[model samples]
Target chain A: MGGDLGPRATVEGTARALQSQSRLSACVFGPRALLAAEVDALPADLRVAAERLTLCDAPRVIDQAMKPSQALRAPRDSSLAMMLASIADGQADAGVSAGNTGALMALARRALGTVAGIPRPAISTAVPTRAGGRCYLLDLGANVEASADRLVDFALMGAVMARRVDGLVAPRVALLNIGVEGTKGSASVREADALLREFAGLDYRGFIEGDGIYSGQVDVVVCDGFVGNAVLKASEGLARMLMERVQATFEAHWSSRLVGLLARPALRRLKRELDPVRYNGASLLGLNGIVVKSHGGADAAGFGCAVGRAMQEVDQALPRHLARELDYWRRANASVACGRGVSGADPRRMDADNPQR
Target chain B: MGGDLGPRATVEGTARALQSQSRLSACVFGPRALLAAEVDALPADLRVAAERLTLCDAPRVIDQAMKPSQALRAPRDSSLAMMLASIADGQADAGVSAGNTGALMALARRALGTVAGIPRPAISTAVPTRAGGRCYLLDLGANVEASADRLVDFALMGAVMARRVDGLVAPRVALLNIGVEGTKGSASVREADALLREFAGLDYRGFIEGDGIYSGQVDVVVCDGFVGNAVLKASEGLARMLMERVQATFEAHWSSRLVGLLARPALRRLKRELDPVRYNGASLLGLNGIVVKSHGGADAAGFGCAVGRAMQEVDQALPRHLARELDYWRRANASVACGRGVSGADPRRMDADNPQR
Candidate 1:
């Protein structure tokens, strides 16, 4: 509710989502008067869908500059905290927000908590691939610089998302590295690659360069949050630049503009297929209750996509699935740690044999 | 000559460049007989241009999989070594190679050496920007995990390149980070920001996020080789994917096909501007002699662009300029270390003052 565009985009998005997804019911949280004004402005065709949308009053707003710590203290009336409380208290199946990312994650983690071993939740989203499919990229901004073990945690969560959400049997997972060679990238990514190779139950494809993320070869691409965020934002920037350049090309001459009109329908289809708004939602994985984060600058259509993501996560019961998966992963790794012979990297053998050989 | 496309593209590219740049000459390196065969088969139109080209015999070829260390030992007959030797021996002003990148760097650094303060050379390239200008992105794949000091060294080197090669005064330099906020990114980037702030003689902008690289507001963007290489390769891949998607959209329907025919001219113009081939050269900055690395997969037109970059660097006397700049930097930093109260962070007053205040 406190995003850059405030409730105008969020509430309108809810009405749109309600119209398209007939079963979805929404609890829109904001200042009472502002929320009422937006809700009252819905069009006539959406009157029946508006019946499923409820507005809840809140007195305070968590602005972007407020630190997560400052916002967490006695946040009784904030929209973000109230929305999470609804999910935590079992009144709502899932939640979606366009508010401050730091405050949202902090309040959601505090309210919903994480699965047994994961310290915090990760942000996972789908990226369009060259083959017209999706690649799930994780730790988008959840952890600034993840440790080797934490990257493995992201890999596990991302894999489960690809499996349960996309229905892949054994999603091919890879670590985003500078090079595909064994000795490349930061120490954390290198160490994570080694750990994933031995860990059971996941199909661990080897290292992948950033370009490979869009090659349709990998089902999940995992990286530290800084690199992940950089890649996603870089792609967004490049896409925007390219789209603008293409438009400028058509409008540069009247002859091309006439041709552009003829190609308009196909061009529009292409734009819709590649638009970031259509793929707006990013799931906060590891939380007990589902929480999807919409991009802060997302428009009404984009915010509607975020709502759709929350609905899908609710239907799949994603948090419950993740908890079960993590339970299996922990026991499996625990056994691998207990038995020296199982890993094949036994130090006892290394003493007598050349490690490289 | 040892690149993926081999000498077919390299030799053809040399002929093309010589034709266009009448003053340019080339030494084509390969096995004696093979080099003669390619040179002898040049088109009639390029025969006059071919007269300015020389063929140098080389017995060995360094390959994609060869370790840089192994390539260093007795590279007497390799084409890459011969090319660097020509520059080292003062027979040529600059060098361009489509050979193995690792071998090329190791051989060039061993042959020509670096400036006073630079330990190793960095890969620097001009990336096309949204405003039709270029941004110099450095350490594209050299020094994968750059230290804070190393990043500062890159900044100094990149600044010199922008000033000399592009003739810009005080080129705006920035550290590529996850967020523009001071608290974000890895410790190395944060440390580099502090170091850059204190160092004199350059326009040091605060941190910029990944997306800002394209804005054309900054003339130079610096990052560790790991991040730089990832950003670059991801961009190349995404651009290729987008271009392919655009073509597919045009060909998907019958009516769109006629529109594509009418739009072909403008689209062709658009492709040429955004094409990776047109931006082939990545200068090995900090080296005493100029060396440009071409994309291994580049065609003749692309390899020709690499040759053109080498020519520009030769004209600029980049290494000599870099040496002078580094001298000034070392002296400035040495004085900063000796002076007190000049930096505003005088530690002597710590007993009476709170650091934050």
Candidate 2:
């Protein structure tokens, strides 16, 4: 009903996730017959836990090519829209999808709305870094353009997520820019930098270059969705290309082939460690409810990871925590200039009533 | 005398480049005493060819922290200004530096103005891709924001570079965007896509996502400087991180340690294949003269690659070839719609007289 692999992968992944999170339950929203068939095919152990599964029939499917406007116009019975609607209606604590990103964002925005002080929800995911640590990068493909205030909001939300989820007391935050220098980047980024510095609660580390994303220097990297999306995909492309080359090189010469055989176990471990599947779940942050976007092309294991991510956010009550923190920031903004040297911020934009300004 | 490592790396790299390209000659611009010492310390063979090297004694250096405007306002006698002046004055065919990018771009643009059809110069360099090929990415950090027509100019310039330097007859060109769908990118990129399609000579391949940059699916990837710079640096950072992880994995356990020793040769070979140093030089394209920007942190061997890159472009007559192709495009535009359905391009902007329109 969702993603490229549709209900088959989704159902299997849910079953896989259930094995680990025993307390978890799901209302599978898709074609009733399809869900029923997949549910029937679940192993005996999972079938015994069938009482936890609810097949919420959603006959219509949103095609990958569907535009956000088109998706919004789609029937309420559509799987993606229905899944989001469940979250809105208080029937579901969280929703996860591997559907079209634009459509998901549009529907999610319409259904869940935003937490106070947040102009829009952003796509955020943890990127593995060189130091064997993780850096949370946001606005992967949500809002293409972000204002300075919006960027500040993203920083706050990201920091909250990192602190709460990643267990960091004061997670270091940085704005993604062309260079680390204050002089580099677009006017919006420069403005964001100023505002981030003023964000009273954030542990703002200023700017981080594209390469610095993986340098493990910061915990959260904020960017407008355009740059964030580009960086994420480009990095994935490079890693895939490099892995292919590594494999090819191992098989190139007979002498090397011998070494490749000896290194096979270690290489497998290395590949697993760097596997994109392990990092599959991308949280649509800043929303009033938790929604994880699994990679559409992901298999069961990858989708399972996405489910696991959602479970963690739900268990930790991510939305409520984010809402409370955002409220605190908004209230604090009236009296104090958040921090020192808050540059380039429009006073009109900083006004609480016009968050999008 | 510039860059992080200063004169020694430059002197050594130049010497290394000179050995490979026997016809190559250079003017070392820096403090006379320091240049003389480094040049004097060159290997015996390179020293024997000292007659070919000219040490231009410029007393001042442009610090890395200097802003572009600051560098521009600096005395014409400074080392950077002197080096670029040499290229402009016909004393040098090309200029190479590992100094400040913004400073270099400003100085390079001032010294060598833009070609007739190009509105501004773009920084382009080859990024190693998966299919054992190189993808030329442009506007690395030149124009933070580019118009639709300017993006078309980048494609033409990039295609010309690929054809002349890489010897590709018709390089497959693509605009870097968030999504492959025509509807996915910013307004500028969409317009560029339309304009690129109209350019009859280009093997225009529409849009490619970030991951596609390393997918080897396209020969040239075009973007505004901001995104391009971020992508380049992010990829470099990611590659470095992955390499480190691979090394650590090999050392994690006793059994893996034994395999690591046996597989050292293959790993070294892998490292060389994906070496960032091998792809060190970035050409300031669209400028009237050749200017290569080497990575500031690069060592002697890495700097040598940048010199080698500059030599290749010089030998291939890159600027001349680019001028001819651009001229061909301009002429063709008058008679034909470059291709079909060119969208969002300002007709006035396409005019040579209104380059900034």
Candidate 3:
């Protein structure tokens, strides 16, 4: 409801999700009249599927301009707040939004709290790779300056998400750095690298450069919010630019345009395979409840993907899995520390985030 | 000589450059016999132009696995060192390398030294934009954690390069951050934003996210090496993936294969437009002598592009322009600081890298 496209895309996307996922019921929180009208304006089949969708009145909207603190101080009647509240109140198994990220993150953290041993929930999303698989990138905008231990936390959380949400038995986790050399990156990354080398419950790959993100070499790439955000956005920009260039090339000549028509199916499949809309859903990982954040400018298909992502998390019980895996790590770390006298094979000490002792 | 693809690409690329630029002469520094073999292997047309190319025997090799400090400690007979020495000895106006980035930057800064008011050289390159224009991105991996002042210095250098090399009236310079808001980035970026707003040298467009880089709205984007490196590599990765995906799409089905043949010209043009080889050259800015770094894995065409970029920098005297523009800003800053009683403007103070007062 608080997205850039108003209620049109969300309502239409909700109808689409309901149509596709038969058991999925949506509680759309927005201005009831506006949502109802948008729902009525949908196509016949989708409109009929709207019977599974209910609307709640949330007149207030948190826009992109509002700061996180300012958003918290504002009225609780905002759509972002109400949606998270619905999750906390147990009326919804999961929630999704395309609102101001800072506002949504802050509100969701407050409403749902965080998982055990996790102070802040990080944002995680799967990016399309060259192998037709997905590589998960985390801390997209949660903590701007994650410490070395926080990076370890991100690796753990991201590995958990990749394993459960994406059905990977043992996800390959790597820290994002400028270079692959041991001495190439920031101090925190180096420290995290040393820790992850031994703190393994999963396959801990070494440092990965940004170019390797799409190479499909690693399953999960962990970084601070700043680096993650920059990489994701820049990748999106480059993808869009390439897609446009492809289209413009087809439109250059009449013969080429005719060829484009013949190749429409292949081109269309290429576009679909590489579309950002299909990957619009970003999971706010390490939260007590399931929440997915869609791109604000996403179309109906994109928003529907976010809804689908939320449903997947709900079905997988992602948060519970994260907690269980994290607890196992804590116990493993504790035993290792006790056995090794806190100096040998005790990688937990390398993490400043060791639950703050 | 230190790149992933040995001297083959470098020697062939030099021949190609010599063939294209009638006046361009190069002193190839590798094993003389090896380079001679590669030179003799070129096409007859290119071999004839290879008359202007001279081969200097550099028997020592510094592989990518070596650290920067270790590279310096190693024998100076390496091809990388000889290339810089040629430039320093006034035999060459510029130098290009596809060696290890850390080694290259370290060696170049040591050999060429830095411009006045700048302590280090930043890696700068032009990325293709949506509008068929190029946007300069700097500090690609030179300084991983650039301070606020370093970011400002990058902005100035990038703006000068854009103005002279690209010949824009006034480059729209921007600070790369996660979000555009004043409160949305790291402390250094925020401080640089305040500084750039009042610095009064170039047209500072304030903050730009990684996604906005390709929008063609700005001519220059400045960021720390870590963020810049991540965004750049991710972009290159994405572009490569997209190109491969397009090719795979064409080869998908039999009917599509016919369409691909029909659309070969258009598809070729699109591939040519988006190829990473076209943007291979990365200029090492702020150095006293011109140096361009090609991709380590670049093909002959890519390495030739790097040589071409070096020639362009030499022709335009990019380093001199940067020094002059930076001096202008310094004088402007000094006058404003005096007139405003040090509180009015004084963006220089905002930059902790202000030559230590």
Candidate 4:
């Protein structure tokens, strides 16, 4: 209902999620007629319990430039807001959307609220690294300018999600910078480094250069939204360009086409390994409830993957564990400005009354 | 001789350059005895002229840290400094080095001086786009924080180099930002957009996102060094990771290994097409003389390619042409600070007697 493709893909993805995992349930939010039509379109065998699909009639709010008050304000019964409200009311375990990113972030912040001790939430994406392993990049465009304390919070939250969601034990985390040296980056990086170094219950691997992200040398990379956005976009652009070139090269000559036929299986395998759909979902971390942002242009299958990923995160209790970790670390480092002890309570704990967690 | 692997690779590359182009003349600069030994290591017919090989016994000021003073303090008798001085003195047409990047930039600025109207120079590298075409990226770690005026200079300089160096006519220029929309991105991008829109000489293509860099939608991409460095490193890391995974996949099973062997030629061709050596040289634009920077880890073959690239730039009179263009653009848009006019002066008209440009 949120993305460019809208409910068609959402419905298809919902069916896939049910088919892929028997225990999984979905609360599809959109116009009741549209949701009903989408569900009706699914294969009979893949259809789930009627109660599993909750319909919330949300008016479409696709663009951010529209007046926030005029565009986002709806009759209290709007679909997008209702879905978030459901999460806040403990009716839904997690929320998933392939809609306008800015709108989604704002909705989640208002309805679900930020996690305890976190000033601002960050969006984290799992990118397939050159090492054939996946690495988590945080603040992927959530907050453009982050303070030292906020970055530390991002690292803590990212580490928890990587471990709980991805099942990585003792995940290696690094601060993304211009160079690997301690003194090489901006003031924020230096301060974050000092804070991260003293934090407990995590494996902090110091500084990582931009090259380290795809090198697969670390499990988690933390940076402000600006740098992370640039890296993610650049990688995506390069991947697209490479695929196009490979196709063009194969079609250049008859001999090359023959070679292409022979290499088709290998090439397809490579393409599958690098498919964006499989890695399309991104977690909006530091929110009270789990919310996964799928690509705006995602198809049904891609949206389905996002749904499955959201379920995984919810079942794993990533937000709770991260909240506890933040509490523990802040308490331990009470002398620091960002420490939980100094604040007398977790900063993210302010949103606990929102009913999401 | 200042890079990790110096005269050994440099001498070998020099020999290859001579063999490749009969009309090319190279003046080797380094410790006379060390260079003589390296030259002697080559076969008689492949050996370079002894008189062309001049030794300037410069003491190493810094081990790996590239300081401006280290380049400046290098003995006049030493190869690195002398080569730069020779270029400025008109004894040599161009200077190429697989040495410290900062040192090269500093020396080039000190000797050759900045181009007319350009405040700061930029290092632009041509990367193989996924579109089977080349795209130039500028400020690849030269100036971390760039002003609006500097960004405009980068666009103009990059466009000129793309046309003259890569042979792209009417090269399309793009300013890299967070999004393709004109209103999106940081304040710097917004300011740069306004500036580029007013410059009529540039074939400005408005805004391009980070993902557009590898898409081959534009001939030249411009950004601050900080963003450019992050993008370049991430791309390199991703490519390496992909190649490694392909190798690991091939080695997974006996049948896969056989498939890999059969597809070896195609893979080799792909590797060659993407090889960094094929595009190893990066020009320090805005300098009076031609200066090319090779990768620190470049081997003999990479070094040779850089030398050839520098020769091409010299042959095309890149600096002079850029200088004239900046002057023309500046005078044309005198009311507005178009290109060089934005920097508040004609940089090309600076005193040659000044030690620092």
Number of the top-ranking candidate, with DockQ as the measure: 3
lDDT of each: 0.82, 0.83, 0.85, 0.76
Candidate RMSDs in Å, in order, are 8.0, 5.0, 4.9, 3.4
TM-score of each: 0.91, 0.93, 0.93, 0.91
- Candidate 4: lDDT of B317? 86
State the lDDT of candidate 3 residue by residue for A158-236, as single tens digits.
8988888888999999899998989989999998898778784769999999988999999999999999998998888
Better of 2 and 4 by lDDT: 2
All candidates: DockQ: 0.59, 0.72, 0.79, 0.55
The residue-by-residue lDDT of candidate 1 on A1-357, one tens digit each, is 766788989988899999999788889987889898988887777778888999888777787777778778956788888888898888889899998888898898998777635788889899899988999998888788798888888999999999988889999999988778776678898888988888888999989988998888999999878778877887888888888888788778889889878878878878988999978999998887889999888988899999999888877778777766665665678654333222333333422231110
lDDT of 2 by residue, B1-357 (tens): 777889989988888777767799888899899999998887787775566778999999999899998998999988899999998888888899999889999998898887644667999999988777999998898899888878888888999999889999889999989988889878999988877777676799999999888888899999989889888999989888887877787888898898778767878988998898999999999888899999998988898899889888888877776665676666667444343233334344333432210
Q: What lDDT tens digits, residue by residue, belong to model 4 across residues A1-357?
A: 767777888887877877777787777776678888877777676565444665666654345343334335645455667778888888888888887676677778888777665766799989987656899998888777678888888888888888888788888999987666664566788899998898777799999878899877899999888778888988887777766656565656677677667656766877888888998899999887888999887898899889888988878877777666666667777676544434466445532543335
Tens digits of per-residue lDDT, candidate 4, B1-357, equal 756687888877777877787778787777677877887886675654433444455444323464656657765555567778888887788888877666677777877788674666899888887666889999887787788878878988988888887788789999987666665667887898888888867789999888888887999999888778888888888877776655565556676677667656666777788788898888889888788888777888888899899988977888877776766666666655732434455545533322121
> What is the lDDT, from 0 to 100, of the residue A20 in candidate 2?
76
Q: Which candidate is the best by lDDT?
A: 3
**Which pairs clash inside model 1?**
none
Please give the interface root mean square deviation for model 4, in Å: 1.9
* Reference-based lDDT, residue B166, model 2: 91
Alpha carbon deviation, residue B11, candidate 4 (Å): 2.0
Clashing pairs in 3: none
Error of 3 at A185 (Å): 0.5
